[model samples]
Target: MKSLSLLNKLKDYLKPIREIIYGLTLHEMDLETKKARGNLDQLFMLVVFGDLVGLPLLPPYYSMRLLPYIIPSLERWKRSVLRERDLTDFVSTDL
Candidate 1:
């Protein structure tokens, strides 16, 4: 409720809602992103870069300000985002 107004005010500046949802679809699938596991990174990026395409989660000020809170989390998120999972990982691990 704190900044819901800001979000509504900036609605026009948001990125394409659909692309924010799908931008990392293939990459995420390829990484075998666990359910609920990739949600935050995608959410963060969607906020950080959403305007590039229409549906940003938070206003830019909030997004930038929120960055500090997620700094440590962001590093881990980045690791997960950049992690490469070879097909062999699936082949090697128990299914």
Candidate 2:
């Protein structure tokens, strides 16, 4: 039928636009997922290494056991945790 052909043509014309929108949405979701993963990593590090900051919630033996798995990120986590932060630092960074 003419109507069915017109509908098919309309969908063909919009396919590129649909693909673009889907790609953009997927990209945005991926970025958000990465950010969330980073936040969780930071929190896990804080809990595991809190003793360095004098919290000492976990036993040293367990912390050492988990240390090897997180060794790559240890330096950056230490720097971020130990750095002196002012109100200006809070304002400058995306919290």
Candidate 3:
């Protein structure tokens, strides 16, 4: 019982310290990774379904075949592709 109590206290004491270390060391890297992944997902969507938005990179038959798998994210992909961007959008991600 004493050992368990001490271990719980140690964990509670270290929790904030561990989070602080992660915030300082890993948070930015995690954000960058997520950003890169989202960009790649959008790019993949563009290649597979660009015809929907008028770019026509793939044949309609192929896009149609993949349509069911892609349906859930289609609206989000379209919005991201069609939205306006500016220099600030690029600048914010770098910092």
lDDT of 1: 0.63
Provide TM-scores for the models: 0.36, 0.52, 0.72
Q: Candidate 2: misplaced stretches above 4 Å? A: 1-22, 59-61, 80-95
Better of 1 and 2 by lDDT: 2
Considering only N, C-alpha and C atoms within 3 Å, which residue pairs clash in candidate 1? 14-54, 14-55, 15-54, 15-55, 16-53, 16-54
Which candidate has the top score in TM-score? 3
Candidate 3 TM-score, C-alpha based: 0.72
What is the lDDT, from 0 to 100, of the residue 37 in candidate 1?
A: 54
Report clash pairs, candidate 2.
Answer: none
1-84: candidate 2 lDDT, tens digit per residue? 999999999999899988898886786677668978977998999887786677877898888788788888889988887889
Q: If candidate 1 were superposed on the true structure by all CA atoms, what would the RMSD be?
A: 19.0
Sorted by lDDT (best first), the order is 3, 2, 1
Estimate, for each residue in 1-95, the C-alpha lDDT of model 1 and write its tens digit. 85998888678556666567666556466555664456756676656555434666677677767766666665566576688998885563423
Task: Output the better candidate (2/3) by lDDT.
Answer: 3
Candidate 2 TM-score over all chains jointly: 0.52
Worst 10-residue stretch by lDDT in candidate 2? Answer: 86-95
Runs of candidate 3 exceeding 4 Å displacement: 53-56, 59-65, 93-95
The C-alpha RMSD in Å for every predicted model, in order, reads 19.0, 6.8, 2.6
